[model samples]
Target: MPRIPFVIPLLLSLLGLAACSPPPTLDQQLYIWQRQWRPAHVEALAQTRLDFSTLRVLALQAHPKAGWARAYPDLQLLKRDGRPLVAVVRLDGQLPQLDPRAIGEQITSLLHDWQAAGIQLAGLEIDHDCATARLPAYAALLQDLRRQLPAELKLSITALPAWLASDQLEPLLASVDSSVLQVHAVSDPRRGLFDAEQAQHWAAEYAARSPSPFLLALPAYGVALLDSPAGAPRVEGEAPLRQGGTRRELQADPQHVASLLAELRDDPPPGLSGIIWFRLPLAGDRRAWPIDTLLAVVRGQPLRPALDLHAQQNGQLSELQLVNRGNLASALPAHIELPAQGCTAADGLGAYRVTSTPQGLRFTRQHPGQLAAGSQRALGWARCTQIDQGGLHVEL
Candidate 1:
C-alpha cells in the first residue's frame, strides 16, 4: 500500500482587496472562528485563579487570507468577565492591504456592529509585513478608522521589532489599543535589527507617554530566519516570508512560550496586557492554540480574554480551555461546571453555544444526535448553535 498524505488547501487571499463587500456584523464575525475548533471540550476557568477583568483585551489571530472569515458566524461566545474592553481583529492577510480607505471602512463596520451588539469593542489588530516607510500610510489608515469608529473603539496593530524608531509610530498606537510588538520573525539582533526583547523595551519606552496596554505576539508557527535559505525568518526583508520549520529548529514550545510569557508577565509596565498567540490551526505548526499548556500557565479567569474569545450578537466565548488535558477519548454528555459563577451542568461539547437568559444560561445542542466520546465541538455555527451553559442536569 502507498503512504497517504494530508490534503492541505492552498487558499487565495482576500487582502489587497479587504472591503469588496459591505462590513460584516460582530455577530457574523464570531461565527468565523467558531468553525476552527471542534470535537473538543471547553470548561470554565475556575482553577487558575487568574481574572479576565484584571487583564486587558482578548483577541484571536485570523488569516482572512487563508479563507477563514467567509463563514464567521454570530454568537455571544466570549465569557466576558467585565466591560470597557474590546477583542482584537487580527487582520491576517484578509484584505488587500493596499487600499487605505477600504481598510478604514472595513474596520469602521466592525466597530459599529460590536457597538450595536452592546460589546465594548476596544478595536482591531492590524498584522502586515511592515515597510518602515509606509508608517505614514499605516497611521493615516488608523486615523481614518478612528474617525469612522464611534470614538470608543480603539485599534491595535502588530509590528516587527526592527523598525528602530517604533517611537515614531507611537502617535498611531496611542489612538488605539496598545500595539503588540512581534518579535518572533526577528530571528537575529546583530545586524542593526531588533528581536522580541529589544522590541519589548522599545515598546515599553514608547508606551510611557501614550500609556496604553501593551502585548507581545509570540510564534505558535515556528520559523528559522533565512540567513542562508536554510529556513530563516526575514523580519524586515523583501524575501518571501518563511513560515514552518522542524520542531527542533522552531522557537515555539511550552518552555520558549513560558520564557516570553514570563518576561511579559514580570514587567511592571502599567498598561501591559498579556501575550497573544498567532492563530488557531496555525499552518504547518505542530499545534494551533495550546489551550492546555496556556491554561496550566495562567488559569482561573472569570471572563475570557478578548484575544482568546470570539462572539456574535448572541454568542460569546467564555473560554475554550483544557479541563481533562490530553483525554481526547473522554465521552460525550461530559459534565461541565461553571462553579465559580454558580452555573454547573452537563452539556455535550457538540453543541454550538450556551445562552444566558434572565432565568439563567441555556445549553442547546447544535446537532440533533448525542455527541460521541472524545469528540470536539464549539458553540456558534448556525446549525450547531445550541445553548449548553445554564445550570442544569442532563444524561448523555
Candidate 2:
C-alpha cells in the first residue's frame, strides 16, 4: 500500500509545530566600564550573577592626549564566580591615525598580562568609533589584531549604526567573530539618549547587514548634559565634570526598554544573539537604574512602585521617613499630612515645606525628587501629644 498520503499529513503537522515553537532565548551580558573597581562591585556582581551570563570589561582605553590608560579592575572579584569574561580595548574616535601593528602588539601584551594574573578571558573586543569613511582602514586594523590574537580567543568589535551606509561595513564585520551594535546615545544629544523605535529599526537593519552573531548594547543608565559655550555639551556619566552651563538630565525609561525587550524576544531578528547592557549599575552609581529595577525588567517581571511612610517615635519626638518598597523607583509624594493634636514642634526636611495646622501637620513638596527602590528618605520630625499613624495621608 502507498504511504504518500500519511507522509504528507505528517510533514504538514511537523511544519505547523515548528511554526508555533517559541523563538530562542536571548542571552544577557553586561559591560563593566568602570575603570576603578571598588568594594561595592562585590555586591553588584553578586546581584547580577543570575541574569547576566557574561561580562565585557573595560581593560584599556587609548586617549588622544593621555595616550593609553589601563583600568585597575579587581581581578579577584571578576574571577571569583568563573563567568566568561571579555576584555575590551577602547580607542578614542578623536585620534587622527592608528598604527595597526602597534595597537595589535599592545592588545596582545595586555592579554598575556591578564592571563598571567589568572584571569580567564573568553574573547577580546575593540571599541573604536571610527568614521564611516575610515571603515576600510578600521577593518585592516581589526584584521591585523585578529592575527595577533590567540587562535582560541574570539575577536569582536563595537560597531556603530552610522557605518550601515558604508560599503565597507560587510568587510568590517567579516574581520571579527562577533559585533556589538550600540543603540543608545548614538544620535544627536539634543534629541535624547535613546529612541526605542529608532533602536528597533537599527537592530533589524544591522541583523540584515551582519553575517556574524551580534548583540544590542542597550542603555541601563543615564547622563547629564552640561551646556558648553565652546561646542557640544559635555556628557557626564558615573561622575560629574566641572560645573558648566545649564544642565539637563537624560535617563532611559525602564518601562519603554522592557517593552522593546519583550518585542524582540517574541520575534528576534536573524543572527541576533543577545543584549549587552551599557553598564552594570552599582549602589553608588547615581545616574544608573536601581539594581532591583534593572533585574525586574530583564526578567520581564511586572514593575510596581510602592512607597511607605514610617514614623519612628522616641518619647515625644517622631522621625518621619518615606521608604520605597517596590521594584520601581517612585517620585516623592507632593503632600503628606499627619493628623495630630497639641503638637509642640513640627518641621519638614529636604524639599518639603512644613505647615503646622490646627488639626495636623502638613508637609508640601517644594521640589521634585525620586526615591529609588529599596531606598528610604527622611521627611521630617514631629512632636505631638496625640498623633494618629492611621490617619497619615500622602498625595503623590
Candidate 3:
C-alpha cells in the first residue's frame, strides 16, 4: 500500500479525537411552585421522571404581613417517585430584615417534618429577591443557614441576575454549594418574559462569579399582563386576577429556548451544572407549555405544529373538536367549516361562534386562544342528517 501523506494522517487523527470527545454533561431539574397540591401532580411527576433528575419544590413562603405559610404539597406523591428533592423557601422581597437564626430554625423544622414524611431531600434552596445592596447581609444569612443545615443536605440560592452587578455576589455564592440563576421575567413586564441573548449573557457572567456549580432557571410558562390604573400592570399567572383591562399575553417560546440550550450545550460555560425549568406544567394549567412541548425542548427535538379537525358522531349529532397532534402549541384557527345538509341545529362553543352558510356551518374565532400540544378542544356541535366529515376545513 502507498504511504499516507503527512497532512492526511494528521487530519484523520484529529477527526478520531473529535469523535472520541464526549458531550458536555448538563443535569435537568424542575421547580414545583404550586402552593397547594392537586390531583394533576401525580401525572405530571410521573411524566417528568425520565427527563428531570431532581425537583426543587416550593415548601415554605415567608411574607411580611402573613409571616410563614407552608405549602400544602402532596408528600406521598412526591416521595413515591424517589427523585432527590430540594425544598425551596421563598422570602418575600419586601422583607425589611433577616433574622438568620430564626429563619434557619424554621427551615430546619420544615426539613425535619419532610424527612419524617419520607421525602428524599437533597438540598435547601433559598429564593430571596433582596436588593443588590443587601448582598453582604444575604451572604451572612446563607452562612448561618449552611451551618444549621444537615451535613448531607446541600444549600443553594435562587440568585438574581441583578446580583451580577454587586461585588459581594462572589461571597454570596460562596456560602452555598450551588446557585440557580433565574433568567426569566427579570425585566419590565412590557418587554416580555424571556430574552435568549440576555439570558446567555447573564449565564456567562454568573458562571464567572459563582465559585460553585450553578443551574439556569428558564421559564416554561406564560403570564398575562392586565393594564391597571395603578402604575404597574397586574400579572395573571396560574390564576386569574379580579382586575380587568386590555390583556397582553407573554410566553417564552420553546424553539427560542431550545436554540439557547443547544448553544449552551455546544460551548457550556464554566461552573454551569444544568438547567432547572420553572414550574412544571400541570393539567388544566392555562399559562404553561404542554408537558410534551417542554419535553421536546429539553430533548432538543424539532417543534412542529399539527392542528386538525375531528368530528365525533353519534346518530344525527356530531361533536366538532379541534385537535393539536404535534409537539408544539398552536394558535386556534381563525375559522373552521364543516359541510352539511339538512342541518337542524348548530352552535359554536368556547372561543368560537357559529354562523349558517350556504354550503355548511362556519365556526369563526371570537377571541384569540392557544391549543396546547397534544390537546383537543370542542369547537362546536352540529346535528345534521347529512354531515360530511371528509369536507372539514380549517383556516389557521
The number of clashing residue pairs in model 2 is 0
* CA lDDT scores, all candidates in order: 0.43, 0.90, 0.91
What are the candidates' C-alpha RMSDs?
22.6, 1.7, 3.1
| Candidates ranked, most accurate by TM-score first | 2, 3, 1
| Clash number by candidate, in order | 63, 0, 0
In model 1, the Cα lDDT at residue 345 comes to 36
Q: What is the lDDT of candidate 1?
A: 0.43
Pairs that clash in candidate 2: none
Where's the lowest-lDDT run of ten residues in candidate 2?
238-247
- List, residue by residue over 249-346, the lDDT tens digit for candidate 1: 23344444455455655453555555554433212223233344444333322212111112232342243322222311123333332212333332
* Tens-digit per-residue lDDT, 88-129, candidate 2: 999998888998867977887888889988997999999999
Cα shift from native, residue 268, model 1 (Å): 2.5
Q: Output the number of the TM-score-best candidate.
A: 2
lDDT of 3 by residue, 301-370 (tens): 9999888878889999999888999999889999888889988899999999999899989999999888
CA error at residue 62 for candidate 2, angstroms: 0.2
Model 1 segments beyond 4 Å from truth? Answer: 1-74, 79-87, 90-97, 111-120, 186-211, 219-251, 263-273, 277-286, 299-396
